[model samples]
Target: MDREIAYGAIGARLETKLNETGLSRNEQAESLGISRSALATYISLERIPSASTVARAVDRFDIDPRWLLTGDERDRITRDQWVAVLSAFVELKAIMDRLFKDRIGWHQASHDDRMKVYRAGETLYEIGGISALNACANALYEGNPGAQLGAGDMLNHLFNGIGPWRA
Candidate 1:
């Protein structure tokens, strides 16, 4: 297949994932670490995501890269992979719930303090069989209308240089 045609297929899959997450374009952009206009270009099939972006999506969403790129619906991930994904999510939820138990925003914390927490999150993401899943969940919760104050603020803090864990 031509590269453009393949990109179009991938773009369609990206659209489907975006709809599945029920997030607005801005939220999706943030989750993907891309700008809104970049996402727009992707959705319009004007350009494809970079390799890093594609890898990020796979890690962040538990997406099967093969299916994402080729539109092959067959499950590429093994049962073990699925289990690991679920387990990591459960662990991450526990971790976040514990970290935010006080329900006070870490937004006001110093940079070093926040960086410590952000580093923790990054470590867990690397070693816990979950890649930026916590951030994805945060973005998801933040985007949802019913999400309250304690949800999804970590990513914002971390990205904005404030970090995520409580000081």
Candidate 2:
């Protein structure tokens, strides 16, 4: 599908999900950590939600990122996969928290440092952030190395092969 058309379809699905929530638009926007106008734009297919926005929505609403972006939620991920996803999210969030904290203290970080954080966050989003991380984890469990390789590679580089975290 073309990008525009796919986004429109995703937007339509978003609208349906929102309606199913039984919340007003403003309330939904607040819950999603976005402005009403931004949500409206997404519903109207004027723009796609960024990875950051998707992550926030996943967190705030307990959404499934795959379902939110692709409208498929029946597939189940294994418990181990869910653990991996959560682990990835926590690791990525910690890195981001540290980056921002340093930036705040020093007024800025090197461009490379900032880009590392940006790319890592984007990888998290691509792997469904906290919401859809399970899907990627499940794929990995099945020996699929091609599940969002950018995310997989970045995670490997940052977390050293997704083993148990130390310290």
Candidate 3:
């Protein structure tokens, strides 16, 4: 990953963890032996967290260090899960292409907007499997009440349904 993208992923993961714990920012920072401002910087992606900071978070919260940095749990995913995810990605891409082509013309859509839709589909798949993913796609394709929302709004709705575990 690019340095900035990696840092952003790490920050997102850290923020997810902190939110999951439901502890005050000051308390979480205190447990990690860092100032609240420092913790804020890390979560805001303004700075890369040091190795010790990562380690402390790993130990304090029982987080997988790899997941904290990479947003993946390779060991936890079985072969079947990989296959499902890959299949879902392919299916989602086709659906999104068609949907965007009809609505805004896929070629005219910004790359970032397309990525948001794909990411939202992936998150839905993770949470409730292929059925959930398909449901979201169907909603968008069928012209549901919220179907007219922009990519960012659709992303927010999809992400709001995700639990902390899926983060």
Q: Give me the displacement of residue 105 in model 3, in angstroms.
A: 52
What TM-score goes with each of the models?
Answer: 0.43, 0.45, 0.43
Q: Model 1 residue 33 lDDT?
A: 98
lDDT of each: 0.55, 0.53, 0.57
Best-matching candidate per TM-score: 2
Candidate 2 vs candidate 3, TM-score winner: 2
> Model 1: which residue pairs collide?
none
Question: In candidate 2, how many clashes are counted?
Answer: 0
Q: Compared with the true structure, what per-residue lDDT tens digits does model 3 show for residues 20-67? A: 998999999999999999899888877656545765786788666545
lDDT of 2 by residue, 27-106 (tens): 98998788999899889977666555655665665566566655555564444543444555555545544644454321
- In model 2, the worst 10-residue window by lDDT is 134-143
Of 1 and 2, the candidate ahead on lDDT is 1
Ranking of all predicted structures according to TM-score, beginning with the best and ending with the worst: 2, 1, 3
Model 3 ranges off by over 4 Å: 1-5, 76-167
Cα lDDT over the full model 3:
0.57
RMSD of 2: 10.8
